[model samples]
Target: MKAIRIYEFGEPEVMRIVQVERPVPAPDEILVKVYAASVNPADYIIRRGGNEALKPLLKLPMGLGIDGAGIVEEVGSEVTEFKKGDRVYGVPNYLDGSYTEYLAAKATQFALMPRSLSFNEAGSLPACARMAYNGMVEKAKVQPGHRVLVHGAAGGIGSLAVQFAKAYGAYVIGTASAHNADFLKQLGADEVIDYNTQKFEHVVSDIDVVFNATPTTTVDEALRLRSVPVLNEGGIFVCTHGVWPSELFKGLLAKKKATVSMAGVDVNHHKIFTEVAKLIDLGKVKAVVNKVYPWERAAQAHHDSETKHVRGKIVLQIYQED
Candidate 1:
C-alpha cells in the first residue's frame, strides 16, 4: 500500500509517498480501501511537529490525514455494524491517518456514507461537518430566529458551520473576504460580511451565538476578542479551534451574562456521522470541496492548506472511484 508519511517535521516538502505493508483489522476494527481523503489544518499542524502538548505523541515516519471515505474490504469478528463492500466515511485514528490506500481502524469510528454524495464529497465531511455540528447544535444550541455569526466563513469548518446553523433555523451571518461573500450566501448564510472591508462587531449586534471557526493564531485570537461585544444577553460563544477566550473577552461576556464554550467533534460517536449523513441526503447540507488533488500530490495539497485561504475542503483522491 502507498501512504503519505513525514519522517521529519518541517515544510510541505517533508511529506512523501512511501510504499508500506497493508494493515489487518483487529478484533473490533475494519479494513477499508480508501477512495478519497481531505486535507485539514490539523494535517499541516501535525506535519510541522504540532504544539508542545502534541509533540510527545509524535512518532517519526507518521502518516498525515484524519478523515476519508472508502469501501470496506473486511471487518473483524467484533464489528457487526459494517460488512464487506459497505461504503463508509469518518475519522480514522489520528495516529493511523487516512492518507493511505488502506485504513484499518475501530469500526465505531465510521458510519455509512451519505447516499447522495460521491466519494470525494463524503470524504470532506467527517472532520469539518462534525466540528460544525458540535458547535451549532451541541454547544451554541442554535434555535429558530437566533442570530448566529460565523468567523472565517469561507473556510472548511466555517462553511459547514453556516449550513448547520441555517439547518437549525438560525439566522446565519458569515465573515469572509469579499470574494467569498456570494459563496457564503450560497451556503445559506442570511448575511455575509466582508472582513476585509468592515469589522463584524461594528456592523452586527445582538448576535445569539458567535462561532469562531478560524484557525488558532495570534490574528485569529484578536478576531475572537472582537466578537465579544456582538453577543446578546446570555448568548454563547463557541470556539472550534480550541482557543479559549482571554480575560478581557471574558469580562465583556460577563457584562452580557454570556459564556464561551469550546467544541470538538467526537469521532467515536457514530451517531454524529449518521445525523450529518441524513442532512446531506436530505439536501439540507453539502460538502464544500475547494479542490481535489491526486494521491501523488499530497505535498501540494498541504501547501495549499497552509495558505489558509482555501474556500473549503481540499481532497486527495486516493483511488479513482468508479
Candidate 2:
C-alpha cells in the first residue's frame, strides 16, 4: 500500500509518498480501499509539529489525512452496518491512517456514503462537516430566524457552517474576502461581508451565535469578537479551533454576559453525521470541493490549505480511476 507519511515536522517537503504495509482491521474496524481524502488544517498542524499536545499520540513517520471516502474491502467481525463493497466515508481515528491506498477505520466513525455523491465529494465531508454540524446545531442551538455569524466563512469548516446554519433556518452572515462573497451567498448565507474592506463588528449585531473557524493561530482575530455585543443574554459563542484557555475565556465571557464553549467533533455526533449524509443524498446540502491533487502532491495540498484562503475543501485522489 502507498501512504503519505511525515518523517520529521517542518515544511510540507517533509511529507512523502511512500510504500508501506497495509493496515488490518481490528474486531470493530473495517478495511477500506481508499479512493480519496481531504486535507485539513489539522493535517498541516500535525505535519509541522505544531500540536505538541498531540505529539505523543502521533506515531512517528505518521500517515497524514483524517477524512476519507472509500469502498469496504473487508469488515471486522463486530461490524454490522456495512459489508464488502459498501461505499463509506468518515474521519479515521487519529491514530489510524487515511492518506493511504487502504485504511482500517473504526466502523463507528464511518457512515455509508451519501447516494448522491462521488468518492471525492464524500472525502470532503467528515472532519469539516462534523465540526460544522457540532457548532451550528449542537453548541449554537440555532433556531429558525436566529441570526448567526460565521467568521472565515470561505474556508472548509466555515463554509459548511454557513450552509448548515441556513439549513437550520437561521439567517446567516459570513465573513470572507471579496472574491468569496458570491460563493458564500451561493451557500445560502443571507449576507457576505468582505472582511478585508469592512469591519464585520461594525456592520453586524444582535447575533444569536458566532462560529469561529479560523486557524487557531489567529488569536487576535478570534478575540476581536468580544468587542461586539453579538450575543444576546445567555447566548453562546462556539470556538472550533481550541483557541483559548478555559479560565481566561470564562472570565471574558462573564464580562460580556455571554457563555463560551469550545468543541471539536467527536463520536457523539454520529447521528448528525448520518443526517448530513441524508441531506446530501436529498440534494439539500452539498460538498464544496475547491481543488483535487494527486496523492503524490499531498504536501502541496497541505500548503494550499495553510494559506487560509481556500473557498472549500481540498482533496487528494489516492486511487487512479481506470
**Highest lDDT, which number?**
1
| Model 1 C-alpha lDDT per residue in residues 119-219, reported as the tens digit of each score | 99999989887888887898788989899999988899999999999988999999998999889999899999988899888999989999888765667
lDDT by residue (243-312, candidate 2, tens digit) is 5645766666687688776756453645767888988877767999999999888878878888877889
After superposition, which runs of candidate 1 have C-alpha atoms over 4 Å from their true positions? 265-268
Best by TM-score: 1
Candidate 2 local Cα displacement, residue 222, angstroms: 5.1
What lDDT does model 1 reach? Answer: 0.89
Worst window of 10 by summed lDDT in candidate 2: 219-228
Question: Candidate 1, 50: how far from true, in Å?
Answer: 0.9
RMSD of each: 1.3, 1.8
In terms of TM-score, how similar is model 1 to the real structure? 0.97
